[model samples]
Target: MSSVESVEEFRAEFRGWLRAHLTGGFADLRGRGGPGREHEAFAGRLAWERHMAEHGWTCVGWPVEYGGRGASTAQQIAFHEEYALADAPARVNHIGEQLLGPTLIAHGTDEQKRRFLPPVRAVEELWCQGYSEPDAGSDLAGVRTRAALRDGRWTVDGQKTWTSLAHEAQWCFVLARTTPGSRRHAGLSYLLVPMDQPGVQVRPITQLTGTSEFNEVFFDGARTDAAHVVGAPGDGWAVAMATLGYERGVSTLGQQVGFRRELEALAALARANGALADPLIADRLTRAWTGLQAMRAAALRPGTAPSTAKLYWARWHRDLGELAMDVCGAASLTAAGVHGDPYEPDDWQRLFLFSRADTLYAGSDEIQRNIVAERILGLPKEVRA
Candidate 1:
């Protein structure tokens, strides 16, 4: 196939492969084999990761020397768009692949790359971020998690909040302070930590929705070999910022795509409940659609998009959720996916609940706007020491 034809062929062949290989519960995401089931969910997740890894999908954006397909940015984007349309679950090892893996490619030692990349590419060891602290949500630089190098090892101590997938993850790419007496942003270092060890404590945080996708992680003298540092000492802030940028920026739009889908489902629900006729809901729907479009356009930008797309998603998701709830009305009976929908049993009820986090996690909407205003807009900084 020609280059152009190859991409098109990849898409067509991929769609068929998805349909064929996606049976036994993946066919209908709402049925038996969805993210709702732990084993099945992880299985489906690993299945896709392995298939992609086999097809060189997992490491598409990585360089050829690092066992990646070395696919172009545009091709990668197209692959993601198509994957989004196919309703793939979030990669079980996104922290490994999306966050740490890339940083490793850019900054890791040769030993680190060879040791970490292949396992990450195969989804063997899941990873999570050890950022957010009880006091350092938006103000990441304020994180108090300190790591002191002792003899030939590092002793880590502190807490991390809202760490997603801590329960299932094997390791965490952590940002901890290694040098003392330096400013908040100075002297910090990034380290890869094993979650199953004795020094780490995982406490699940149940949301208002009664599900705990994120957890509070505490470390008391967590020991690590000094060899695990991602880069030079004191580079943690920059590395963390880059990771946050990737999360909010266009690099990892899988979650944003998830939000877009949730928004789409909301629209369909409005039509079914006759809420499409409600002037308020209709107006809200128009706004939501516009917001989603803007998100898509923003996410498609070539580079980091300079401007982050998180705030847009945060606003759009919360608004869309409220709109869906309103259209369902007061008489709506304990609405849920199982409650009722004009089409399939699945809809945005649970997704609406999930959207509440869109603003809070991955830096709040307030934080995203602060970033855009201060950094992108060159506005005055917020006043507070």
Candidate 2:
């Protein structure tokens, strides 16, 4: 088939599947699980994902031999966009399908691929990332997690903070200090560790939204097989960075779709509450619509577009959250339920609270500015303390 034909076919097929499947009990799952709302209908969502896997819909971007459709880039983006448009539940295995799966395909050994890819494609094994620490959130080079090779196993010891969905994950792809004296990004190894072992402790950190999607993971002598390391030992920074690159890849097209849905819903709320009469609110809404268009265009570009895209969407979403509150008027200040559920924020409240960290997490706005400055504009590097 021609490229255009294939993309059109892929989009049509995916849209049809979503319309057919997102019905009955699953119908209620629409627009439920994403970001801070990951705890919502998790089991149902996982079941939905496994159902997608059963129908060859999961991991469409992966090679056919690796249990994927070997879909073209355009096809993948089309799938994401259609999925979001259908209001499907947020995917539970996105970490596996989007990040680690591609990283393994690039850097992992054949044995590693054989052992891991099937479960990931099957949606049977969930994964989390272990990168940020108390000392190294954005400055990932400052990671202090240590892993030592002894007796054919890598024993890890350290804390990783802000680990998304670690409590629900069965495995974690970790970047740890493998050499004792190594500093910064050197001497790190990317190891896949099991999460169910006794040495791994997961403590959920409740966010301002009253949810615990973010977690603090303590690895006290946690161990993985020596063969679990991806790429050469003491050279994991490159592999880790590659995963970060994937984090900003085509899946973001889907994210923008979700963002568009949010904007539409916020606009409806404003119209219902007469908030659109306010010129300030109206202007912000118009700017938001234009910003989304700019984000879509930037995301289609190459190179530093990912960093720029992240900055654009994060700031835009955070402002949208603020706009949501303004649209809702005084109702945004109160919880949905009565005194017993005083902390149970409404959707707009949750959005505002959760989005406060959008600019701070992943890579902070400051870090992104530095990246654009030094890498894109050839600016001098920032001095470290």
**Model 2 steric clash pairs:** none
lDDT of model 2, residue 215: 98
lDDT of 2 by residue, 1-385 (tens): 2234589888998898888888998898988887778899999999999989998899898887888888888898999999999989989898999999999999999999999999999999999999999999989999999999999999999999999999999999999999889899889999999999999999999999778999999999998999999999998999999999999889999999989988999998888889999999999999999999988887777654678888989999999999998899888887886346867887788889999999998899999999999989899999988
Report how far residue 5 has shifted in candidate 1, in Å.
6.9
Cα-based lDDT for every prediction? 0.73, 0.91
Give each prediction's root-mean-square deviation over alpha carbons. 3.7, 1.6
Off by over 4 Å in 1: 1-7, 25-40, 249-257, 303-307, 331-347
Q: What is the lDDT of residue 105 in candidate 2?
A: 96
Assess candidate 2 and give its TM-score to the true structure: 0.97
Q: Measured by C-alpha RMSD in angstroms, how accurate is candidate 1?
A: 3.7
What is the TM-score of candidate 1?
A: 0.88
Per-residue alpha-carbon lDDT of model 1 for 1-385, expressed as tens digits?
Answer: 2134466666676667666765665554422222222334566666667766776567666777887666665666666666667776655666787778788887889999988888888878888899989988888888889998899888899999989889889888888888887767898899888888899999988764545777999999888888888889789888887776555533445555666676677678778878889898888878877877777777776554444666666767777767767877773436444425432223345445666776777777677788888988899999977
